[model samples]
Target: MSLTWAPALERPDLLAEPVRHALEAMASDGADVAAVEVTEIDPDHADTAVLVEATGWDLRDMANCIVISGARAGEERVCAALVLGHTRADVNKAVRKRLDVRKCSFMPMDEAVGRSGMEYGGITPVGVPSGWPVLVDARVVQREHIVIGSGLRRSKLRLPGALAARLPGAEVVEDLALEPPT
Candidate 1:
């Protein structure tokens, strides 16, 4: 599949409201949001497995964003973890340690969707709520370009890994994710 990537700002219809707003904000801040590209596809192929098979893209170049919630001393903490599709977030050890919480787990799907204002299976860290930490696995930042959700099921976004690391509140966390054991 030869995907034609257009500047995301030129295709607001392909982006969810929050995603469009977030990209616009980034552009205003001189963040070079133009480097972001958007491409539309069948909603059924929005998932990582189907998308990779359909596009022939390497799984390592696809970024998966997961929301996690936990509490430390009764103070709630929620963050988004960005990992490559080939790995899983280390929610039990790495994430809990990062959040300084006794325990942390994936946030409920409905709550994550509602809080992010993005559709489930299509949430990206680009537009997470203010104050929410976005822990990006260090490996994701090493990719030349990473494919991520467009905050909607009908489209996807591609941008330089360095640009992703620059998203507001995003932090590159070493070993934030781990490849599954064979």
Candidate 2:
């Protein structure tokens, strides 16, 4: 099915201003990012799982996962990471190692909502705080196109993987793994 904007993927009208600003900024940068509504699933759900059960597109050559979490107050601003969809973000070890923090944790729902300005389930990489770090898996660059969040849960954006790597603040890394979830 062709991808198009659907009401189900739109964020609530009450979204915080920062999130809206982020979207506008991305647009100003000539990114083809757009808001879309997708089926409401847990934000923590694996992208590979969504691809298999929802899109039915094998991600063997296209996309990888980008899991993000916020740092503790007075610590790094935010922690954005990339991992293969077949695997989970190495929150305890790899991620922590990279951040050089003694501890790291997922952003709380309320904090995420406040800081990201997007609803918990609807956060999209396209429209996030400008200073926030955007990590990408190097493997994703091999694919000409890939799918990612559209700043809402009910929708996803399909774009060139290379562009994703070039998004402002994005950093490509080679630490991603393909291990299956436990």
> Which predicted model would earn the best lDDT?
1
Candidate 2 colliding pairs: 9-37, 9-38, 37-154, 37-155, 38-154, 38-155
Q: Model 1: per-residue lDDT, tens digit, 12-113?
A: 999989889999999999999989999998899999999999989999999999999999889999999999999999999999998999999999999999
Write candidate 2's Cα lDDT for 25-60 as tens digits.
667777654532233334454344654565466655
In order of appearance, the predictions have TM-scores of 0.97, 0.67
lDDT of each: 0.93, 0.55
lDDT of 2: 0.55
In model 1, which runs have C-alpha deviations exceeding 4 angstroms? none
Backbone clashes, each candidate: 0, 6
Clashing pairs in 1: none
Q: Which is the leading candidate under TM-score?
A: 1
Q: Which 10 consecutive residues of model 1 have the lowest summed lDDT?
A: 161-170
Compared to the true structure, candidate 1 yields what TM-score? 0.97
lDDT of 1 at 91: 96
